[model samples]
Target: MFKRFQTKLLQKQVAGGYRLYTHPANASYVEKLVLSWDTRRLTQAALETLAIIAYKQPITKMSISSIRGVNSEGVVASLVLKRIVKEMGREKSPGSPILYGTSNLFLKKFGLKS
Candidate 1:
C-alpha cells in the first residue's frame, strides 16, 4: 500500500514554506530555508511517447507516430531534452530513419535494470 502518512507530511512541508511570513528581518533565514521548486513537468503526449519507447525501444519516429495515431515528433524532442531518452542512431533502411531508446535516467526512474 502507498504510505499515506509520508505523503501528507511532504505536502505539509511544501505548504509550510509559503506560510513563513514575518518581518523583513527574517528574509535571509526564510530564503535560506525555502527550497527551490523543481517544476519537472512532463506533457501527456510525452508520457505516452515514453511508454511506447520503453516497451518498444529502438523504434523509429514513424513507427511511434503510427502506434500513437498522432505526431510524436515534439514529444520525442522534449524527452531527449530531459535526458530521459537518447537516439540510438539510424536504422539500416531506405531513409536511415533515426531510432530512439530510453536512457539511464528512464531506467532509474522506472526501476528497470537492463
Candidate 2:
C-alpha cells in the first residue's frame, strides 16, 4: 500500500519523461536558489558560435567557421561543455562532418516553449 501510494505521489510525466516533484516548501526554496545563482558570461567567440548553431542547428563546425570567417572549434567545444549545444549526427557528405545543434537545456535556459 505504501509503495503504491509513493508511486502515485512521486512522479509525473512531461513531454520528455517522468520527473520527480518536490514538496511545495522545498520547491520554493530551490526556485529561489536557482533564480539567484550567478552564471558566467560567455566569450564573444563562444556567443557568436552559439548564436549560429541556435539559428542554423544541425550545422557543422566547418559551416560555422566559414560563416564567422575564423576557426570555431574552441568556441563550439566550450558551448558543448556548457551543455548549450550537442552533437546531433554526421552530415551525409565527404568525410561526414559531425553536426551540432542546441540542446533541450538551451530551450529551458532561454524560456522557449518548444
Compose the digit string of candidate 2's lDDT tens values, residues 1-114: 977556445577999899877656466676667545432477788788888999999999999999999999998986776777999999999999999999997788878876
Q: Rate the local accuracy (lDDT) of all candidates.
A: 0.78, 0.83
Superposed model 2: Cα runs more than 4 Å off? 1-40
lDDT of candidate 1 over 1-114, digit per residue (tens): 357444333232354463323456556665555423221466788788998998899999999999999988988987886678999999999999999999998787668897
Clashing pairs in 2: none
Q: Which candidate should be chosen as best, given TM-score against the real structure?
A: 2
| lDDT of predicted model 2 | 0.83
Q: Residue 56 in candidate 1 has what lDDT? A: 95
Most lDDT-accurate candidate: 2
